[model samples]
Target: MMDMLLRPRIILDAAEAEDAEALAEIHATGFRRGWSADEIDALIADKTVSSHVLRRESLFGVRRPQGFILIRTVADQAEVLTIVVAPAARGRGYGRRLMEAALRALYRDLVPEIFLEVDEKNASAVSLYRSLGFVEVGRRKGYYAEDHGPGGTALVLRLKLR
Candidate 1:
C-alpha cells in the first residue's frame, strides 16, 4: 500500500557533524528564525548536548533525514533545545518520534526532569508536548519575536523523567 511504502523503516541515530546542513534546512522550514548550519554543528560538537536524527530508509535502500531533536543535559536535568521536521514530512508523527527518542535517552541516563520552551501560539507543538506528559510550569512574556508586532509568550514545559 502507499501508506506502507511511505512509512518505510525509520532509523534513529546520534546526529553527526555532517548533518548540520540538512538539519538546518529542516529547521528553517519549521521556525520563524532558524539556526545556521554552523550553529547546529557547534551544538552537536558540544560535550553537554545530545542530538538525534531520524532517517527514513525506503524499500530501495534510499536513506534520508526526516527530522532531528537537540537536547542539552546539565547535571541531573536536560532541556530540549530544538526539534524540527522536514516540511514535506510534517504531520506524519516524526516530531513525536524524535521527542520519544530524546526522552528515552534522557531516561536511560537517569535524568530526573526535562524542560522545553515552546511558543504559545504553536498549537500543534504544545499539543504534542502535552501528549508526551509535559506540563507548563512557567511563561516568559514576549520571549518570541514577531514579524509585525509584539512577540508571543513562551510556555515553559517540564516532564519528570525519573
Candidate 2:
C-alpha cells in the first residue's frame, strides 16, 4: 500500500476538446446510459458548457484523468450536465473537488443559481450535493431506468450561488 499523503498530486483544470474520449470512458463507468465520445465531444464543443477534469500527476509529471464535471450555463443560471469519478478513483475526494471548482467558476461568472438532477437512489451522490448546499427542489418520477430493476426517481436540486 502507498501512503495517501505521499500519493501523486491531484490536479484540477479546465478540460479541452481532446479529452472527449477519455471523459466518455470515465462516464461509461458511472452511468447506466453513458454518452459516447462523439456526444462528449459535442458537449465540450458547445459554447455554453464549462468542463473541468481532475487528474493525478505523478512525480515524473505524467497526468492521468481521474474524474470530470460538465456544466452548462444559460443566461444567469447553470445546470450540471454530468459528474463522475473513475471507479478506481472513488473515495478520494475527487468528486467534491470537481464540484467545488465548478461552483467557484459559476459563482465567479455571476450565475445566480445552479441545478442538477440526481437519481434518488444514488446515496453517495445525493450526500455530496447536499453537503455542498444543494437543496431538493423537485423530482421526476421514473427519470432513470435501471439495468435490471424498476426505474428510479430523479431528485432535482438547486444551490444558490449569488
Error of 1 at 89 (Å): 0.8
2-78: candidate 2 lDDT, tens digit per residue: 68756898889988878889999999999988999999999998999999999998878888899999999999899
TM-score on alpha carbons, each prediction: 0.93, 0.93
Clashing pairs in 1: none
* Alpha-carbon runs more than 4 Å astray in model 1: 1-7
Q: lDDT value for candidate 1?
A: 0.93
Give the Cα RMSD of candidate 2.
2.3
Query: Per-residue lDDT of 1-162 in model 1, one digit per residue for the tens?
Result: 988877789899998988899899989998888999999999999999998899999889976889999999999989999998998988999999999989999999999999999999899999999999999999998899988677889999999988
Model 2 stretches astray by more than 4 angstroms? 1-6, 148-150
User: What Cα-based lDDT does every candidate model obtain?
Assistant: 0.93, 0.94
| Per-model C-alpha RMSD | 1.8, 2.3
